[model samples]
Target: METITNRTLNLHEAWFWHEEEDRLRCRLCAHNCLIAPDRSGICRVRKNIDGKLYSLNYGRLIAAHLDPIEKKPFNHFLPGTQSFSIATPGCNLACDWCQNWQISQADEVGSLTRIPEVDPKKVVQAALEFNAASIAYTYTEPVVFYEFARDTALLAREAGLKNIFVTNGLITPEANADLVTWLDAANVDIKAFDQDVYRKYMHGSLEPVLETCKALKAAGIWLEITTLLVPGVNDDPLQLQNLAQFIANDLGTDTPWHISRYYPQYKFDSPPTSLKGIEKAEHLARMAGLRYVYPGNTASSTQTVCPSCGKLLVDRDGYRTVLNELDDGRCPRCNTEIAGNWA
Candidate 1:
């Protein structure tokens, strides 16, 4: 494959957008940015050039890696399996504290300073060569790279592989309605529960994120949630309770919740989430009737246990599984079915 460092023009016509009188409205994400002539959406990857919205980042792989599914932090999805993860530059949400800001946040919208434009088939072949069970559209918001992920996922599924997303969950309902078919599992990062925090920090809204989670669940795609617990930000008891309750009531109690410990990074200089703080957030989530909860970014045991019989199903040391005592996606002891893509 050949690598092109910079792309001046894009020909791939984008989906999920309609042309207005002069500008185009991109409905891929909740931003719904109206693009003028020669301008890009909020994502900075989809540009309106000469009256059509085109995906500037499609198949432009800024990063690709073979990673354990657990590293995606998808505890319940496909344990002990590896995923072929890929990402392009640009994300719809402008998260200030994004860990992968170098790739996720584009410097410009019109011109792309991207890597090799790998074909969708090439990504599938790479996944197969690596013996990956799934292709994870991760490390950045997959919504902005929808066309690439979608085409690649189709080929991946044909190759007997699964598709997943490690997303910010800012996808619009229309986009997710179509994505639910392509994706088999997803690990959504619910940045914070407070709407105010979302606007001020992430430059987005919270309700769409919640909606995307629900839509994914209702579509039978395996859903898991991660909340990066930043101390003194989204660590409040009441807020955590409501979020946990929403998961239990709307999504389900079986939805695995990962309360991640946040370290000071990027633009945010807040103190790291204390060990005690993550534990408390876990406590509140469990108290709200959520069956599976785990602490993240810490050396904690991310074990999966039977909510019915208390039998340990999966025992893990970091991303490696030491023991998985389940039988065909069900608890061996209680015979209760776990909600995940075990196959």
Candidate 2:
């Protein structure tokens, strides 16, 4: 048989172990998908071949775009800079309210669309071509395509390009440790702080995501958290307070938290989260000792204000950012060292 280089049975290395039933159990995330012979894991990318696991979607680039780093909800890292975003199909968790459901919830065989087969070298080249300061593995779970992302990140780092992973934060500790060596920054979707909410709505566990957040912070990666406030679901004030406190205590007060206003889409079309609700969440987050909390998905008054001098650090008018109070990563008014990278 001819070797299909572009679409190899690349399998996975960080998330599986051989089982007694001639199967491979994936431990990459909390799922622990048990794959039978010639079967694929729950993520739909990793497969068990002859009792060995491999990532089938390695280097299979399905989508690419140039987007502002702030769209990743990473306000404290690199504000208003552009990042080359890329992703392969397959996600570890099946969140019903996923915005990118078209790409994320594809079949295991991948017959949903005509996706381009791209290699790691090509991905790095695309980032350079687009003049992006970084490449973001987004749209779907980058962990499912670990080999491809790892290889591309190796080349991206060599090319003086940073790599960001926009993930669900459901990865195992070992997987996170293996990945943090390559990831420079991340915007993890916390989903919700409630375990039952996670289990019912996200079909995943909350503890692993929390653990991933702690591990990422420990690894010294630029960490950010985003929570889509769905009305009548995960939008309780107490739950939001718990989420904020968790970020303050575990992830630190410096960690930027983006409270995204959820709109009706996908499986849960209840209603969009009200702007009033969002503002209230921001208020609670500030009271919880979180230094930086921003509202997303609307043109609200969520400007980045300097905590020391009360000067507007970065004025953002619907993603068009104007850096007024920053002078090389420090607040110009108070000389307080800002937490983000200005250049």
Worst 10 residues of 1 by lDDT: 1-10
Deviating ranges (above 4 Å) for candidate 2: 1-16, 112-114
RMSD of each: 2.8, 2.8
| TM match of model 1 to true structure | 0.95
TM-score of each: 0.95, 0.93
lDDT per residue for candidate 2 within 149-230, as digits (tens), equals 8889999999999999999998878778889998999999999989999989888899989999999999999899999988
Which 10 residues in a row give candidate 2 its minimum summed lDDT? 1-10
lDDT of 1 at 159: 97
lDDT, candidate 1, 136-205, per-residue tens: 9999889898999999999999999999999999988989999998889999988888999999988999
Model number with the top lDDT: 1
Return model 1's CA RMSD, one decimal.
2.8
lDDT of each: 0.87, 0.82
- What lDDT does model 1 reach? 0.87
Best by TM-score: 1
